[model samples]
Target chain A: MKTDPESHQRMTQRRQEGHVKKQAAATVEKGLLIVHTGNGKGKSTAAFGMAVRMLGHDQRIGVVQFIKGALHTSERDFLGSHAQCDFVTMGDGYTWNTQNREADIATARKGWDEARRMIESGEYRMVILDELNTVLKYEYLPLDEVLAVLQAREPMVHVVITGRHAPDALIDAADLVTEMRLVKHPYREQGVKAQRGVEF
Target chain B: MKTDPESHQRMTQRRQEGHVKKQAAATVEKGLLIVHTGNGKGKSTAAFGMAVRMLGHDQRIGVVQFIKGALHTSERDFLGSHAQCDFVTMGDGYTWNTQNREADIATARKGWDEARRMIESGEYRMVILDELNTVLKYEYLPLDEVLAVLQAREPMVHVVITGRHAPDALIDAADLVTEMRLVKHPYREQGVKAQRGVEF
Candidate 1:
């Protein structure tokens, strides 16, 4: 709203210079512990996006699915076949299908074993433990043991854990934590079916 | 916790059956209008993840970046070169940067033109208008005009708009609206630089 256009431009230009300077000042590099948890969607999707970025960068990545089970998803089909990715789905189904406690715990244990291998392998730059938080929530896998493995993994290995009900302890350990808050879901509101490509 | 194992298993099985029944009942099909907003880090990344899904399904996609400008990201390098994607970056830089008002408005206009083309063309199964919310929040483009164009586009085209401060009207129009809530960010708390293959 400044009548003097030159003065307005100068003010904006100065702010940009300050930003550039700040950007240049950051030099520390450390592998991040990232967590995605909440009631909304896109937690695992965002992790998959990072996997794509890693693959694009020519870095090998590992993906382990805990609660999603063997339901074929487009992401699994694509990433599993990619040369740079080692994708594994390790569950019979969701936890609510009578196998809630015992059977689910056994499945989660197997999944964690595979995930731990990928995290410590040193061959991978990133390891995605998809739906691991849900397993942790049910105490299917020992949270302390899982955290120890993550903390002691390869120096530059980034780990992404996603699922609802992330424990307070895990949040404290994470470098970046995003909660995908659900504003509106068609399935809940209008009984809309989970469509292909969008949902899977 | 039920001590009678058979009873507990039967109860859970019944619940799962009910869930399966509900899942099978939904039969509607329609193109989605999705909005990803909030102050969190994964808004754009999730949309890119959907782009990967669309790509995995072998469906062509169109991506038009609004306020991001010409930053060279790993995603751009990946998706731009992919045969199934048509990617275009339009704008100078972030809103706070020098070319704030006048210069930025002109850039937004051209970008909208490209987005409109993709939406109406029907060739692209999905079209992502990245950061269009920020431009709309700044009033660079008339809200009514953008809504009208979105409303009249191809019925089967999935359009995704992402950024912070999404307008209420747009939220009402979208089939899926997710707010990526920022629970924790390392860059803000620890001054950590945006690392390769994660932030970019």
Candidate 2:
């Protein structure tokens, strides 16, 4: 009852092909939610990497920079020139530095509105919500509203959220999550100022 | 004229603040074109790192896998799950492996079609064209077409073309170009076959 060598080889090849097909099916689905969280400086930097990656692939991408009203960073400066990417920044500025709660909330809402439009319209394949944690931290934007918008986004639209202290609800809803733990910081110790290009 | 100590102190503080502002401005204006070209592996891996970075910052990203038609690679597997990114593959499999020349050109044309749509639409901040060199090397896709696509794309769109044998035109248009020369490969030198998670 032994199988022929030639027949066995044919069966093996068929099995291999089947496996490859199965793997392909697993990845062909659309849309995703990715979050980057931690006490490190590169959270936004990491998100920017994905933005550029998408641009190269020629997919529609929309960006909403929350709590960062200044619009004076390297990412903004360079990405502003990209035709495919839509860069939107809250004109109000930072909360800790600005020390204006009302102003922060107003700015957050403005950015959130634009983000909501992009997410709902399905005009963009991917939407990035940067420094969202800061908006959540200051309670400038409601958590429920954020969740609702994310939930309402087109089924195939991917969303990225970045910042420290990601809300538990956001984390629960996210398809993938990455947390960057900070072991040491120059600011916390010797009070060294953040360097350009590296920090921004 | 001799200045008083108080005035000197005030001037120093102002100068320091001005320096910080200048640094921020410089970072904002600094343009970049990052190329990860090489014979060694990880060009796409490094490019993916950039993708994640941009995504974290809420930058819009697009990805185009040129010669790779199969969807089972680990890189695609990981990124496929990201909700904040959009990805498109040429789906021609490998050029060297595919037997039909006309079919290969048609596949390349389809990929270039999609890539052009993404570029002209101005919807992405960065676009990653994977294994494009292999297409250029085979001449299935004309070098001028690639150049025109890059040139016509938004000036701000940061383009990254991966795979081996990058053309001189691409390198010339690129703001920053890197050549990954293979010192030693496991396949040709060690006779080790491609491994999942490592090669794919």
lDDT (Cα, 0-100) at A163 in candidate 1? 90
Candidate 1: where are CA atoms >4 Å away?
A: A1-18, A69-72, A98-100, B1-11, B69-72
lDDT of 1 by residue, B1-200 (tens): 33355765777688889888888777676678999999987898888888888888899999999866422388888889999999999967786674547777899899999999999889988999999998898788998999998999887788999999999999988888999998887654456677777887
Q: After superposition, how far is residue A112 of candidate 1 from its true place, in Å?
A: 0.9
i-RMSD of model 2 (Å, 1 decimal) = 16.8
Indicate the worst ten consecutive residues by lDDT in candidate 2 chain A: A183-192
lDDT of 2 by residue, A1-200 (tens): 12354554465466667655544545334466767676643456556656665665667788888856322366786566788889988745544444445565678888889999999999887788988876786577889999998888787787878777888888788765666444233222323333333244
Candidate 2 vs. truth: CA RMSD? Answer: 14.6
Docking class of 2: incorrect
- RMSD of candidate 1 to the true fold? 2.7
Residue-wise C-alpha lDDT for candidate 1, range A1-200, written one tens digit per residue: 23245665777788888888777877667789999988887898889889888998899999999877422388888889999999889877777763557787788889998999998878899999998998888787888999899889887899999998899999998999999998987653466677666787
Can you give the TM-score per candidate against the true fold? Answer: 0.92, 0.48
TM-score of chain B of 1: 0.91
- The share of true interface contacts that also appear in candidate 1 amounts to 0.60
